[model samples]
Target chain A: MSEAVDAFNIMVYRQLKRFVRAKSRLFGSIVNPLIWMVFFGLGWSSLFKGSMAKALFGGYSYLDFLAPGVVMMTVFMGGFISGVTVLWDKEFGFLKELLVAPASRTAGMAGRAFGDALVATIQGALILAAIIPLARDINPGGIPVTLAAALLTGFAFTSLGITIALKISSMEGFHIIVNFIMMPLLFLSGAFFPIDPLPEWMKVLAYLNPLTYSVDLARISMLGSGSMNPLIDTVVLAASSLILIGSAALLFREATID
Target chain B: MDAIVAENLTKRFGELVAVDHVSFKVKQGEIFGFLGPNGAGKTTTISMLITLRKPDEGEAWVAGLSVAKKPAEIRRRIGVVFQDPSVDRELTGWENLWIHGVIYGVPKNSLRRRIRSLMEFVDLWEKKDTPVKHYSGGMVRRLEIARALIHEPEILFLDEPTLGLDPQTRAKIWDYIEDIRRREGTTIFLTTHYMDEAERLCDRVAIIDHGRIVALDTPENLIRRLGGDVVYLHSSSDRLEELASMLSETGLASDYKIIDGKLMLSVRDASKAMPEIFEAARKLGVKISEISYKRPSLGDVFLHYTGRSLRDSEGSWKETARIVVRRRR
Candidate 1:
């Protein structure tokens, strides 16, 4: 047990050092979401105000309606970027070194996932601070719960990213997958708009995507209103997280570390 | 007792066989060299022995634990330095060593002292706080050796330890390897394409070609078997076979071959046989454009066993094929 802890700590320390060294990556994780909140939210406020957005959000502004979605976006992008680090390690031969070391594969995956989740949380928090003053209707009293949701959601998506990174053979393939999977999931999750009025087919796809559940939960917790039941969304998000996290661990266990 | 042993070990990737029925044993405290051209399964075999890769057939025991069944035990008992550099470029030298020590379950107090001693030994104590990316190639290689030794395993495996380094640095690495062996009596298992490296460091060397051990013996014994002298006579024309027959008839030398328009022969004495060799060349009207004779090096031993030079054979067709297969999705 101590050995496993040591391995996890070492893995975490290594990743933290890498993150510190790569400042551009730190900026990239938060910059995307901050842009969405500031430019898009302000631009869309006059267009989306005093409609269902106001009613469902308890008279909240359009900027408030968009805040949770941007937070979830920050988590998702941060999680996806985490996988690129694993790919870098693979290309640089450090992955082989870690695999050959006297540590369990479980510990290795856990450490990497934790590091990714930590980065996601930090980026999400920073973006949230930037978005909070802009979204006047948001209740600052829910900050603690919102932060918890971001951490769990980030962890779930980070695990998913790591699982994909482990199975994919090359950086090019991973990039193709991120394009095919991440972008579409973000669109269908209703990050820019509510999912209630979408076509039946689109609704089903959104339900299937775990990101939608995360966005819905974030929306309900932060803005206090969304079309979906907040309780049901939380449950679904937690279950989806468990499934992906379990599968990631299994995939990491079976992965050939070479 | 043998520090490492393999019995008919085999590993396959899909239909391609990487390591085929390979078997060998290294007695405790011997610097055994596993010499092979790239893709002759040297790294694959070493990975299996270190419990990093699973063998498809047969079994290997490292420090008395079956590598197939008791990989964790084997991992605990062995240290590995991979061919590519493994040090974390982001971490300082001392931090890298400390992290490795901690992961390997070293006590904190002991680790502090070990890190200092190891850095000092590798001549990196002055730069211990600097990130590895700042270190020279030779310094990183030495730090890797230090990292491997931190756990103090009974057996250590170094895969191409001095590859891609200057000759001077390579010799320095060789000196460090020898010093470690003398000081600690660690069983060293290393792989190299450099004949001089094998000849200098390894107590016994196995020359592997095409996934099979072609020759296994002490370097001196392998060279002695090749008659201690190599004579290369490059002819102007492709008349090597004819010249070889004529030289045989003159009763000057034995064990000769005509390869690539060169008449390569081995003899006990080159000084005494040169006169007769020249006479035979003159009689056959063979133009000896280049005539060179030297004490039989490991290159001669490799040529004797595989009929090809080590330097030429590395990164050959087999390695190219392996890379193609490895790169395939």
Candidate 2:
């Protein structure tokens, strides 16, 4: 049992060390969400702050509503990069070394998912802290709940990312997924705008997106106003996190390296 | 007990059989060499032994544990350096070794000292903090060898360990390998196409060709089995067959054949038999324009069994002979 834990810790330590050592990635993760909150949020909040702003934004400014969305988006995008790193490991021949080790592949996969989720959650927390000054009336006590939502969302996406990386053979194919699936999911998940004002068909997609629950849960914690019940959002995000992580582990056990 | 035992192991890809029904055994603490040219099932055989690929037929036992039933146990007891460089280039050398040792369940109390000693043994102690991306090819290979030994496995499998290195560096790697076997008494199984590597490092060699073992024995024994020194005589006229028959009949050469209009002779001692050979050729009216004799090498043994040069095309001996004839014409 200790040896299994050792394997898990070794894998997690590797990812953490590599992630921290990459200075460019650290810089990018900080600057990226700022662009979304400052430029996009400030630009669009003006148009929505008129008489209809209270009704559309649940009695708050556009930046306030968009802050929670941007936090979830930060964690969401960060989780997506876990797959690229796995692909890079495969291409560079490190995956073979890991596969041949006596350690369980399931333990290694869980460690990787958790490590990536940790990094993504840190990035999400950074965005949350950065935007707290720009937006008003954020419940200080709800900060823990917002972070919890970020972590759960990151874990689910990281698992999904690894599963995709295992199934796809090439980085080019992963790029196609980024353009087609990831971007579409991000836009339709109510991260950039309110889902209630959307057409009926789009609302179904918003409801179906796992990110919608994460964004809604974050909104309830940060702003005390959300479209869905907080309990339902929390339950759905936690359950999906468990399911995705379980599937990723199963797929990882069958992963082969050439 | 034998460290490894393979029985009729086979593997196929589509319609092609990569590894045929092959069987061999390696004694404990002995260095065994699997010698073959490229695509001669060398890598495939090693893959099966290392538990990376499942065999299509037959079974293997590594360290007395079945590869089919207990691959995890086999993996725990053995270390492998793949044909391709498998080190993580992004991580520092120290980090790479540390992670590998930890994952392999090297005890935490001794892991640090083990990594340090391994790095120093491979002469990479100063560069341990540097990322592997900055390492030279030979350094990367040395680090890989050291990492494989971190857990002190019972057997070490090296697949073309010194490939693509300069002769000096290759010799250095050889010394390290020999030192490992001497100090730890670990069973070393290595595959290489270089004749000198097998001849110098292995206690026994199995020469594989076309997915089969053409010959298997000690280097000296394999060469001895080829009879003796080889003598090549090129005649000015097409009288090679007459000269071959004359030399064989007169007991000047133990065996003689005609290849490319040259009389090829296998003699016990070429220098002592040269006078007799010249006399026989003269009586047969065969003018020997050029004559050369050299002690048999592993290459000669390989050719005697496989009937083709190791460095040549992948075709069978008959096809190679036909190609040679066509080129001459």
Candidate 3:
């Protein structure tokens, strides 16, 4: 049992160390989410100062409403991009090394998911740190809970990402496939805008999206502008995170060297 | 007890049989070599033994545990250096070794001690902190060898370990392997198509051809089984092949072969057979332009069994021969 734990910790340690080693890769991946936050936050500035804005935003600014969304986007993109490492490992033949090791593949998968999610959470945390001072009515102590929610969501997304990347053999194929699915998952998750005024069909997609619940959970904790009960939102995200992680582990056990 | 055993092991992909009913055994602390050309089932057999691929028909045992029933136990006792580079290039050399040790459940102090000794043994101690990506090809291979030993496994499996390295580097890698064998008495199971690599590093070699063991013995024994000497005959004759059959019928030579535009005849005494050989050539109107004799090599055994050179078309000869035989039936 201790050996299994050691395997998990070492795999996660390897990922984190590589993450620190390749600053350019980390920097390149976060660039897109940074652009989304800056452009959208500036474009919608000064629109939430009146009492009419209070009803719409629950006494928070548009920038604050979009802060959690943008942070989730960072974590979301970070998690999604993490799966490319598996493809890279497969291409470079390092996956064979890990598979032949005495440790369990499930342990490696769990550790990888943990490491990528934590690294993604760092991006989410950095975005929050940058936007918190510029925004108003922020709770300093609530940051940990919000980050935990974001990490759980990140783990869920990264697990799903690995599942898809397992079937894809090339980096170029993964990029094309992720772009097609990610944009739709992001836009329909009520990320850039609330789902209040969307068409009936679009609302259902937003409701079904696990990303919507994750972002909503963070918004409630960070901005207190949530549309649903925080408990229900947290429960849904946590349960699905477990489900996705379990599924990822199952698929990982069957991963062949071929 | 045999350190490793495969009983009627078989693996197939669609219509192609990658490893067909192959069985073998490896004794403890022995160097076992599986020699074959590309696509001759060497990799498939190693994969099955190491539990990387499951056998379709039979079973394998490593360290006295059935591979199909207890793969984890076999994996725990074995170390593998793949034909491809399997080290994490992003990690430092020391870090790669450390991760392997940790995963194998090597205790901290023992792991540290083995890492120190193995790194020094492989001459990679100075580059332990360098990321593996910057290391040259030989350095990465040496570092991988060090990593595979960090866990102190009983049996080591190396697949084409010296495929693309320079000759000097290849010799250096073999020196490290020899050092390991002398110090730990670890049994090594390596697969390679390079004839000399099997001759140089292995105690016993199994020559696999078309998913079967065509020959298995010490290099000297297999070569001796071919003949004492190999006579190379290069002649000018439009009917050289017909000349070969004529010579065989005239009690001059049997099992003559044409390879690389030269007629090779395995002779027990080349000097004693020279008179008859020249007379047979004279009768067939084929002049022996150049003739030389040398001690037989593993190459002769390979040709003797498969009737083709290792460098002959990669897996094509086997396919063509199989098709012709099938049509003949």
Candidate 4:
């Protein structure tokens, strides 16, 4: 038990140390959401006022409606980019070193995924903190719940992203997956705008996406507003996290480091 | 007791046999060299023995634990240094060792001292705090060796340890490996394409080719088996076979073969055999362009066993080389 705790601390420290060394990567994770919040959210605010935006965001203002989406966007983007560590490890041959170590496979995956999820949660929280003065309606009563929602969302998405990265063998394949899956998941999950404004098919697909539940839960926690039940959203996100994490662990079990 | 024992261990990828019924044993404290060409399954065999890859048939026991059934047990007792630099470049050398030590269940009290000693052993103590991304190729490799040694396992496996490094750095690594072995009596399993590396460091070597073990013996014994001296004679292409036939007829040497536009003849005494060799060439209308007599090296031994030079067989980058290591649950 002591060994396990030591291993976890070491793994977390390793991640933190690497992150500090590669501040540029951390910056990259932040830039996308910041741009969306400042430029897109502001620009679309006037264009999406009242009826059109209300229909999409359950009657919230465009800027207010977009904050939760932006938080979820950060989670999705950060989660997808978490796989870059795996790519870097492969290229640098550090993956083999980690595999040969005495740590369990579950520990290895959890260590990395937890690091990414933590970063995602922090980035989401920071974005929320930055936008708090702008979105005055965001309740102080919901701060803890909003943070919990953001963390759960980050954990779920990052696990999925890491699993994809582990299963895909090449850098090119990883790129294709990120571009094809992550972008669509982000846009359709109502992160930038609401899915109700989109075609009927996309609305259904958005509901199916795990990111939607995260966004809904985050919005409800922060603004005390959401179309879906908070319980349902939490359940969906939690279930998705478990399934993705389990699949990743299983994939790691089967895959051999060359 | 044997540190490792592999019996008819085999692994196949689709239709291609990566390791074919390979068998060998390493006693405790022996430096066993696994010598082979690029696609000769040296790494594959090592992977199986290390429990990184599961074999399709047969079995291997590492430190008395079955590689197939008890990989965790095997992992606990063995250290591995892959051919590729496995040290995390983004972390400091000290951080890398610390993480590895922790993963291996080293107590925090002992971890710091162990890491310092390991870094000092690998000559990376001064640079321990510096991130490995700033390290040179050789420094990264040294740190990797240090990382592998952190747990103080009874056996250490180094796959092509000095590949693609300058001779000076390679020599330093070899010296470090030797020093570690001497100090700890650790059983070393090393793989190399370089004959000189095998000759210098290995107590015994197994020459593998095409997923099969071709020869297994001490380097000295293998060279001795190829005969005392190797005579390199460059002659006209037309008379190459004729010269070989004439040498065969003289029966002065037990082994003779043509390689790379030159006829290499092995004999007991090159000084006495040189006259007969020249006479045989002359009678066959062979005009010798270059002639040199030297004792048989591991290169000669490899060529004799595998029918190809190690240099020619390396760095193909064929699909066979793309091995993925997945965690086993």
Candidate 5:
């Protein structure tokens, strides 16, 4: 047990050090969501407001509806790119050093996912901090729940990223695969729009996406109103996070080193 | 007890057998070398023994545990430095060593002190705060050696440890390796194609080629197997085979072969054989253009066993082109 803990802590420590050292990555993750909140959220919100927007956003403004989505998007995009670090390690040969250590592969990968998730959640929190003043209707009591949703979203997507990273060898292949999977999932998750107004086929995809549960949960916590019950959103997001984490661990355990 | 043992260990990639049915035992605290040219199964054999790759045909044991059965146990007891550099370039030297110690389960209290002493030992103490990307190649290699010892493993496996380094740095790295074995009593297993490195550092060498070990013995014994000195006789006549037969029949040469249009003779005493060799060449009307003899080297033994010199096997089309371009100039 101590062995696993040691491996896990050290991997987290390593990832954090790498994340902090790259100043641009730190600055960019925070700035990215703010751009979406300002350009996309406010831009679209101005054109669609009052009773029609209130009906669409459950009495909240379009900016308030878009606030939680932007926060979840920050976490989602941050977690999705976590595997690029793993791919770099593989390319630069650091993965061999990690793999040959006495520590379990599952522990190492879990540590990586946890570290990535933590960074992604922090980025989400920063975006929330920025959004709190710009967007009204955020319940101060639901801040904890919003952070929890961010963390869970981070863990799920980071694990998903790592699972894909373990399969793809080259950077080009990783970007191609991740971007291919990411664009559809992001658009289909109803982050940019309401799922209720979507066509049946698009609504089904939104329901099927794990990101949808996270976005819904974030919406419930921040706006105090969402499409699904808060309990259902929480349970689905938690289950998907565990499933993705487990899959990443299993793939890491069977991964071969050269 | 042997620190490591392999019985018919083999690994294949698609149709290519990377490591053949190779077997050897590394005794406790001894420095053993796998000497071979590129793609000669050295790295594959080390990978199998280190538990990175499983043997396809047979099993191996490391630190008394079977590689196939107890790979985790073996990993805990052994340290490896791969041929390619594997350090985290973004991290400081100190951070890299600290992470390595923690991951290896070294007690947190002692890890800092251990990392300090290791850094000092490798002469990287002053540069510990610097990121590895800024480090020289030699400094990174030393840092890796220090990191590998973080666990104080019983056996250390280095696959081409000093490859792509200058002679001075290679020798310096060799000193560090010897010091590790002498001070810590760590059994060292290294692979290299450099004859001088094998002769200087290893107690026993296994000459591997074409996915097999063709010879295994102490450097002296392996060289001694060549019988005596190597006599290089460059004859004016292209019919070197006729001269080889004459020298062999006259008992002037114990063994002879035509290499690069030169009659290479392995003789008991080159001085005694030289006069007789000249007489034989005179009788055949074949004038000896160049006559030189030297003590047999590991390269000669490799040639004697594999029928090819290690140095001569590395000529590529690019190298040939460079030579042709230089001649034109």
Candidate 6:
């Protein structure tokens, strides 16, 4: 078991090392969300300056309202991007090395997910740092709480990415699904708009989206305002991510050895 | 005791039999070569023995552990350098080795020492800190060889370790491989269609064709099947048969045949036979294009056993593997 843990750590370290060395991916993840925050947020804020829009943000400026949402976006993207890398490894033959290693594939998969989650979480935290200079409404003490929420959110998507990528044989197939799935999850998660104002059917879908919970949790922690209570939101997110990550591990075991 | 053993191991992808009733054994500390034509099940066989894929039929044992029942155990005992390059190009040589050592459960205290020795062994110690992307093809292969031995596995499997390398780099890689075998006495199993590589590195070569082991023996024994001292005589002479008959009538040569537009003769002694053959050609007024007598090689052995030269299978494994995968999909 200890040996497996060691192997797990090694696998995680490999992913982290790769993520760090890439350098561009780190800066790359930040640029997209930063643009959304600066241009989209300012543009949308002016439009929302009307009475009909102020309540949607709870009187917080559009930048202040969108900052936490942007952090969650970073976490979401980082996790999935990390998960998609297994396909690269599979194509290039590194996964074979991991599979042939004495360690458990579950441990290896878990380590892979963890490395991605850690990188994603760090990226999320960097966004928070960037946001802090612009958005004064963020609670200083709630930074750790919001970061934890980002980490959990990253794990859930990272696990989902691993689970889906494990079943998908080709990297092209994975990219299609990622591109297809990423937009709906982000747009519907109440990141840019209010879930309450959405149509009943869309609201149901928004509630079903895991990113909604992640965004809600991070947004509430940072802004001290949200649709759901922090405790309940965190509990549901934690439960679902655990289940997703657990099943991801199981799927990884089946895919690797069999 | 044998370091590895396989009994009637077979794997089928639907109707295509990738490996059929394949059985072989490698004695401890011997360098065994698996030689075959394209898509002849060499990688499939290696995959089975290294515990990457389970055989659909029969059993294999590596380092005394059953591959079927104790795959993890088997995996722990063996190291493999895959046909495709497996190094992390982004990581430095030192980082790649460190990650491999950690995955293999090497202790923290000895990990640095082991990495140092392995780096030095492959003569990459000076460039240990350089990213693998910056390393040359020969350097990457050497790094992979060292990575495979990081855990001190009982067996090391190399799949076409020098596939695209130049002759000089190939020789350098072989030197490192030989150094490993000499110093560690690890049983090395490699797959190659290159006859000379097998001749130079292998104690026993197993030649497979169409998912079956056609011949298994030492290089000398395989070549001996061709019989007699070999002579290469490329003749453009129109009366080639007449010249061959004239040479044979002299009783200087025993057996001869026209292979690939070249007249190949096997004689008891070429030193005494070459002059007589040249005199006969001169008397017949035959035009000999190119003639050179040399000892038999593994290429001859492959030809004698399989009726096809190793050159015929060159650069086909990749295409074959791609087809196999496409068919599987």
Off by over 4 Å in 1: A50-58, B231-299, B307-316, B319-328
TM-score of 4: 0.87
Go through the candidates in order and give each one's DockQ.
0.47, 0.38, 0.50, 0.47, 0.37, 0.62
Cα lDDT tens digits, model 1, B276-315, are 8888778878888898888866566778899988777765
Shift in Å, residue A69, candidate 3 = 0.9
lDDT ranking of the models: 5, 2, 6, 3, 4, 1
lDDT (Cα, tens digit) per residue for candidate 5, span B1-329 = 99988999888766566678998999999999999877677888988888887789988889999988998888889888989989999999999999888888888889989999989999999999999999999999999999999889999999899999998999999999999998899999999988889989999999988778898999878876778787998976966798898788877678888877787898988888888888888888888889999876656777889898867755532353454345333
Taking chain A of model 1 alone, its TM-score versus the true chain A equals 0.92
**Candidate 4: residue B252 Cα off by (Å):** 12
Tell me the native contact fraction for each prediction.
Answer: 0.57, 0.63, 0.68, 0.82, 0.74, 0.71
lDDT of 2 by residue, A144-248 (tens): 999989889988998888887777777677778788878988998888888988999999998988999999999999989799999999899988888888887
- lDDT for model 1, on a 0 to 1 scale? 0.81
- Residue B159 miss distance in model 4 (angstroms): 0.4
Query: How well does chain A score by TM in each candidate?
Result: 0.92, 0.96, 0.92, 0.92, 0.96, 0.95
Q: For candidate 6, write residues A21-112 as lDDT tens digits.
A: 88888889988888888888888877777665656677677778888888999899889878877677778677777778878777777787
What digit string (tens of lDDT, one per residue) describes model 4 on residues A37-127? Answer: 8898889887887686677667788888888888778877776677445776776777776676656777677667777777778877777
In terms of DockQ, which candidate is strongest? 6
The model with the greatest TM-score is 6
lDDT of 5: 0.86
**Which of candidates 2 and 5 reaches a greater DockQ?**
2
Q: What TM-score against the true fold does each predicted structure earn?
A: 0.88, 0.86, 0.87, 0.87, 0.87, 0.92
> Which ranges of candidate 4 are over 4 A from the true structure?
A50-56, B229-299, B308-329
